[model samples]
Target: MIRHIVFFRARDRADVGRVLEGLSILKTIPHSSRLEVTLNGKVDQLGNDVDVVVYGEFTDAAALAAYKAHPTYQESIDRVRPLRDVRMAADYEVTVD
Candidate 1:
Protein backbone atom coordinates (compact mmCIF):
# COMPACT_ATOMS: atom_id res chain seq x y z
CA MET A 1 0.00 0.00 0.00
CA ILE A 2 1.03 3.57 -0.60
CA ARG A 3 0.17 6.44 1.64
CA HIS A 4 0.17 9.85 0.03
CA ILE A 5 0.17 12.86 2.29
CA VAL A 6 0.52 16.49 1.31
CA PHE A 7 0.71 19.66 3.37
CA PHE A 8 -0.21 23.07 1.99
CA ARG A 9 0.11 26.60 3.27
CA ALA A 10 -1.88 29.40 1.72
CA ARG A 11 -0.18 32.55 0.54
CA ASP A 12 -2.83 34.50 2.41
CA ARG A 13 -4.82 33.39 5.43
CA ALA A 14 -8.04 34.39 3.74
CA ASP A 15 -7.40 32.00 0.88
CA VAL A 16 -7.27 28.87 2.98
CA GLY A 17 -10.79 27.93 2.06
CA ARG A 18 -10.06 28.47 -1.60
CA VAL A 19 -7.02 26.30 -1.26
CA LEU A 20 -9.06 23.60 0.40
CA GLU A 21 -11.72 23.84 -2.26
CA GLY A 22 -9.14 23.63 -4.99
CA LEU A 23 -7.59 20.50 -3.56
CA SER A 24 -10.99 18.90 -3.19
CA ILE A 25 -10.86 18.30 -6.91
CA LEU A 26 -8.59 15.38 -6.20
CA LYS A 27 -11.42 13.55 -4.51
CA THR A 28 -13.26 13.31 -7.82
CA ILE A 29 -10.50 11.19 -9.28
CA PRO A 30 -11.07 7.46 -8.86
CA HIS A 31 -7.52 6.17 -8.89
CA SER A 32 -7.05 6.18 -5.16
CA SER A 33 -8.78 3.74 -2.83
CA ARG A 34 -9.24 6.57 -0.34
CA LEU A 35 -8.68 10.30 -0.58
CA GLU A 36 -9.38 13.36 1.49
CA VAL A 37 -8.79 17.06 1.53
CA THR A 38 -9.17 18.98 4.75
CA LEU A 39 -8.26 21.96 6.85
CA ASN A 40 -5.59 21.54 9.48
CA GLY A 41 -6.96 21.49 13.02
CA LYS A 42 -3.91 23.47 14.21
CA VAL A 43 -3.86 21.43 17.39
CA ASP A 44 -0.08 21.38 17.47
CA GLN A 45 1.31 24.26 19.46
CA LEU A 46 4.80 24.03 18.06
CA GLY A 47 3.88 24.82 14.46
CA ASN A 48 0.66 25.78 12.78
CA ASP A 49 2.13 26.74 9.45
CA VAL A 50 0.13 24.20 7.54
CA ASP A 51 -3.30 25.32 6.33
CA VAL A 52 -4.59 22.35 4.35
CA VAL A 53 -3.99 18.63 4.13
CA VAL A 54 -4.52 15.95 1.47
CA TYR A 55 -4.41 12.31 2.46
CA GLY A 56 -4.71 9.39 0.05
CA GLU A 57 -4.19 5.66 0.06
CA PHE A 58 -3.33 3.68 -3.05
CA THR A 59 -2.64 0.02 -3.74
CA ASP A 60 0.72 0.73 -5.31
CA ALA A 61 2.92 3.24 -7.12
CA ALA A 62 0.96 2.79 -10.37
CA ALA A 63 -2.27 3.77 -8.73
CA LEU A 64 -0.56 6.76 -7.18
CA ALA A 65 0.82 7.71 -10.56
CA ALA A 66 -2.59 7.38 -12.18
CA TYR A 67 -4.00 9.68 -9.55
CA LYS A 68 -1.43 12.27 -10.49
CA ALA A 69 -1.89 11.76 -14.18
CA HIS A 70 -5.59 12.43 -13.93
CA PRO A 71 -6.49 15.77 -15.52
CA THR A 72 -8.30 16.98 -12.45
CA TYR A 73 -5.02 16.70 -10.58
CA GLN A 74 -3.58 19.33 -12.89
CA GLU A 75 -6.73 21.36 -12.53
CA SER A 76 -6.31 21.23 -8.79
CA ILE A 77 -2.70 22.29 -9.05
CA ASP A 78 -3.54 25.09 -11.44
CA ARG A 79 -6.15 26.28 -9.02
CA VAL A 80 -4.15 25.95 -5.84
CA ARG A 81 -0.58 26.66 -6.90
CA PRO A 82 -1.01 30.39 -7.25
CA LEU A 83 -2.78 30.80 -3.92
CA ARG A 84 -0.36 28.66 -1.94
CA ASP A 85 2.94 29.65 -0.47
CA VAL A 86 4.21 26.21 0.31
CA ARG A 87 3.28 22.75 -0.91
CA MET A 88 4.89 19.59 0.34
CA ALA A 89 4.06 15.98 -0.47
CA ALA A 90 5.26 12.67 0.94
CA ASP A 91 4.51 9.14 -0.21
CA TYR A 92 5.63 5.86 1.22
CA GLU A 93 4.90 2.17 0.91
CA VAL A 94 3.62 0.21 3.88
CA THR A 95 2.68 -3.40 4.44
CA VAL A 96 -0.46 -2.57 6.37
CA ASP A 97 -3.52 -1.15 4.70
Candidate 2:
Protein backbone atom coordinates (compact mmCIF):
# COMPACT_ATOMS: atom_id res chain seq x y z
CA MET A 1 0.00 0.00 0.00
CA ILE A 2 1.04 3.57 -0.52
CA ARG A 3 0.71 6.13 2.22
CA HIS A 4 0.44 9.75 1.16
CA ILE A 5 0.84 12.58 3.63
CA VAL A 6 1.05 16.31 3.00
CA PHE A 7 1.51 19.23 5.35
CA PHE A 8 0.73 22.90 4.74
CA ARG A 9 1.08 26.18 6.54
CA ALA A 10 -0.99 29.20 5.58
CA ARG A 11 0.69 32.40 4.54
CA ASP A 12 -1.57 34.13 7.00
CA ARG A 13 -2.95 32.41 10.08
CA ALA A 14 -6.38 33.85 9.38
CA ASP A 15 -6.38 32.10 6.00
CA VAL A 16 -6.10 28.64 7.48
CA GLY A 17 -9.83 28.13 7.09
CA ARG A 18 -9.64 29.07 3.44
CA VAL A 19 -6.80 26.64 2.94
CA LEU A 20 -8.84 23.90 4.52
CA GLU A 21 -11.82 24.82 2.40
CA GLY A 22 -9.69 24.60 -0.70
CA LEU A 23 -8.29 21.22 0.24
CA SER A 24 -11.78 19.96 1.04
CA ILE A 25 -12.41 19.59 -2.67
CA LEU A 26 -10.04 16.64 -2.79
CA LYS A 27 -12.62 14.56 -0.96
CA THR A 28 -14.69 14.58 -4.12
CA ILE A 29 -12.07 12.62 -6.03
CA PRO A 30 -12.64 8.87 -6.15
CA HIS A 31 -9.19 7.41 -6.72
CA SER A 32 -7.78 6.71 -3.32
CA SER A 33 -8.62 3.80 -1.04
CA ARG A 34 -8.87 6.34 1.77
CA LEU A 35 -8.33 10.09 2.04
CA GLU A 36 -8.67 12.84 4.65
CA VAL A 37 -7.96 16.49 5.32
CA THR A 38 -7.34 17.82 8.82
CA LEU A 39 -5.94 20.62 10.92
CA ASN A 40 -2.44 20.30 12.42
CA GLY A 41 -3.73 20.45 16.05
CA LYS A 42 -0.26 21.83 16.97
CA VAL A 43 0.10 19.50 19.92
CA ASP A 44 3.82 18.96 19.52
CA GLN A 45 5.93 20.78 22.06
CA LEU A 46 8.63 21.71 19.55
CA GLY A 47 7.15 22.32 16.14
CA ASN A 48 3.83 23.80 15.12
CA ASP A 49 4.82 25.19 11.75
CA VAL A 50 2.36 23.03 9.90
CA ASP A 51 -1.28 24.15 9.87
CA VAL A 52 -3.05 21.72 7.63
CA VAL A 53 -2.66 18.04 6.85
CA VAL A 54 -3.76 15.74 4.08
CA TYR A 55 -3.50 12.01 4.51
CA GLY A 56 -4.37 9.32 1.98
CA GLU A 57 -3.98 5.63 1.46
CA PHE A 58 -3.74 4.13 -1.98
CA THR A 59 -3.82 0.51 -3.04
CA ASP A 60 -0.66 0.99 -5.08
CA ALA A 61 1.55 3.51 -6.83
CA ALA A 62 -0.80 3.65 -9.79
CA ALA A 63 -3.72 4.49 -7.56
CA LEU A 64 -1.76 7.26 -5.94
CA ALA A 65 -0.84 8.56 -9.39
CA ALA A 66 -4.47 8.52 -10.42
CA TYR A 67 -5.42 10.53 -7.35
CA LYS A 68 -2.91 13.17 -8.34
CA ALA A 69 -4.09 13.10 -11.93
CA HIS A 70 -7.63 13.79 -10.88
CA PRO A 71 -8.73 17.23 -12.00
CA THR A 72 -9.83 18.24 -8.50
CA TYR A 73 -6.20 17.80 -7.49
CA GLN A 74 -5.30 20.77 -9.69
CA GLU A 75 -8.23 22.74 -8.36
CA SER A 76 -7.01 22.09 -4.84
CA ILE A 77 -3.55 23.30 -5.78
CA ASP A 78 -4.78 26.36 -7.62
CA ARG A 79 -6.90 27.38 -4.69
CA VAL A 80 -4.44 26.60 -1.90
CA ARG A 81 -1.14 27.65 -3.44
CA PRO A 82 -1.60 31.36 -3.10
CA LEU A 83 -2.78 31.21 0.52
CA ARG A 84 -0.16 28.76 1.75
CA ASP A 85 3.20 29.63 3.30
CA VAL A 86 4.69 26.17 2.89
CA ARG A 87 3.76 22.80 1.48
CA MET A 88 5.43 19.49 2.18
CA ALA A 89 4.59 15.99 1.03
CA ALA A 90 5.83 12.48 1.61
CA ASP A 91 4.88 9.18 0.06
CA TYR A 92 6.07 5.79 1.20
CA GLU A 93 5.14 2.20 0.70
CA VAL A 94 3.65 0.40 3.67
CA THR A 95 4.10 -3.33 4.04
CA VAL A 96 1.34 -5.28 5.69
CA ASP A 97 2.42 -8.78 6.52
Candidate 3:
Protein backbone atom coordinates (compact mmCIF):
# COMPACT_ATOMS: atom_id res chain seq x y z
CA MET A 1 0.00 0.00 0.00
CA ILE A 2 1.12 3.53 -0.68
CA ARG A 3 0.04 6.59 1.19
CA HIS A 4 0.20 9.79 -0.83
CA ILE A 5 0.07 13.09 0.99
CA VAL A 6 0.07 16.59 -0.48
CA PHE A 7 0.16 19.97 1.18
CA PHE A 8 -0.80 23.14 -0.65
CA ARG A 9 -0.57 26.85 0.01
CA ALA A 10 -2.94 29.10 -1.88
CA ARG A 11 -1.86 32.31 -3.57
CA ASP A 12 -4.57 33.98 -1.53
CA ARG A 13 -6.54 32.75 1.46
CA ALA A 14 -9.79 33.28 -0.43
CA ASP A 15 -8.67 30.84 -3.10
CA VAL A 16 -8.51 27.93 -0.69
CA GLY A 17 -12.09 26.87 -1.34
CA ARG A 18 -11.54 26.78 -5.08
CA VAL A 19 -8.36 24.77 -4.63
CA LEU A 20 -10.15 22.23 -2.45
CA GLU A 21 -12.99 21.95 -4.92
CA GLY A 22 -10.61 21.33 -7.78
CA LEU A 23 -8.71 18.69 -5.81
CA SER A 24 -11.95 16.86 -5.07
CA ILE A 25 -11.97 15.73 -8.70
CA LEU A 26 -9.22 13.26 -7.83
CA LYS A 27 -11.83 11.12 -6.11
CA THR A 28 -13.12 10.09 -9.52
CA ILE A 29 -9.82 8.58 -10.57
CA PRO A 30 -9.62 4.79 -10.38
CA HIS A 31 -7.45 2.63 -8.08
CA SER A 32 -7.58 5.00 -5.19
CA SER A 33 -8.46 3.05 -2.05
CA ARG A 34 -9.15 6.25 -0.17
CA LEU A 35 -8.99 9.96 -1.01
CA GLU A 36 -9.68 13.08 0.97
CA VAL A 37 -9.17 16.85 0.63
CA THR A 38 -9.12 18.90 3.78
CA LEU A 39 -8.56 22.44 4.96
CA ASN A 40 -5.87 23.12 7.50
CA GLY A 41 -7.46 23.93 10.81
CA LYS A 42 -4.70 25.61 12.68
CA VAL A 43 -5.57 27.73 15.67
CA ASP A 44 -3.29 30.46 16.95
CA GLN A 45 -0.31 28.83 15.34
CA LEU A 46 2.70 30.85 14.29
CA GLY A 47 4.35 30.33 10.93
CA ASN A 48 1.76 27.77 9.76
CA ASP A 49 1.55 28.38 6.02
CA VAL A 50 -0.20 25.32 4.67
CA ASP A 51 -3.78 25.90 3.58
CA VAL A 52 -4.96 22.55 2.27
CA VAL A 53 -4.02 18.90 2.45
CA VAL A 54 -4.82 16.00 0.15
CA TYR A 55 -4.66 12.47 1.52
CA GLY A 56 -4.74 9.45 -0.75
CA GLU A 57 -4.16 5.75 -0.26
CA PHE A 58 -3.27 3.61 -3.23
CA THR A 59 -2.75 -0.12 -3.69
CA ASP A 60 0.76 0.28 -5.09
CA ALA A 61 3.11 2.32 -7.23
CA ALA A 62 1.26 1.44 -10.44
CA ALA A 63 -2.02 2.56 -8.98
CA LEU A 64 -0.47 5.80 -7.83
CA ALA A 65 1.03 6.35 -11.25
CA ALA A 66 -2.29 5.67 -12.92
CA TYR A 67 -4.00 8.12 -10.64
CA LYS A 68 -1.46 10.78 -11.51
CA ALA A 69 -1.85 10.15 -15.22
CA HIS A 70 -5.62 10.12 -15.31
CA PRO A 71 -7.11 12.91 -17.39
CA THR A 72 -9.45 13.96 -14.64
CA TYR A 73 -6.55 14.25 -12.25
CA GLN A 74 -4.65 16.27 -14.80
CA GLU A 75 -7.58 18.60 -15.22
CA SER A 76 -7.77 19.08 -11.50
CA ILE A 77 -4.09 19.87 -11.36
CA ASP A 78 -4.41 22.38 -14.15
CA ARG A 79 -7.27 24.12 -12.43
CA VAL A 80 -5.66 24.22 -9.02
CA ARG A 81 -2.16 25.18 -10.01
CA PRO A 82 -3.09 28.73 -10.84
CA LEU A 83 -4.67 29.23 -7.45
CA ARG A 84 -1.85 27.78 -5.40
CA ASP A 85 1.40 29.38 -4.41
CA VAL A 86 3.19 26.25 -3.30
CA ARG A 87 2.63 22.49 -3.31
CA MET A 88 4.46 19.63 -1.65
CA ALA A 89 3.91 15.90 -1.92
CA ALA A 90 5.11 12.75 -0.18
CA ASP A 91 4.59 9.06 -0.84
CA TYR A 92 5.37 6.14 1.43
CA GLU A 93 4.73 2.43 1.43
CA VAL A 94 2.69 1.05 4.28
CA THR A 95 3.15 -2.50 5.49
CA VAL A 96 0.27 -4.47 6.86
CA ASP A 97 0.85 -7.77 8.57
Colliding residue pairs in candidate 1: none
Worst 10 residues of 2 by lDDT: 27-36
lDDT of each: 0.96, 0.95, 0.91
Question: What lDDT tens digits, residue by residue, belong to model 2 across residues 13-90?
Answer: 999999999999999999888899999889999999999999999999999989999999999999999999999999
Error of 1 at 84 (Å): 0.1
Residue 41 of model 2, lDDT score = 88
What lDDT tens digits, residue by residue, belong to model 1 across residues 8-89?
A: 9999999999999999989999999999899999999899999999999999999999999999999999999999999999
- The TM-scores of all predictions, comma-separated, are 0.98, 0.97, 0.93
lDDT of 3 by residue, 1-97 (tens): 9999999999999999999999988888877999998988866458678888899999999999999988998899899999999999999999967
lDDT of 1: 0.96
Q: How close is candidate 2 to the true structure, as a TM-score?
A: 0.97
Residue 35 C-alpha lDDT in model 1? 97
Model 1 ranges with Cα > 4 A deviation: none
Show the colliding residue pairs in model 3: none
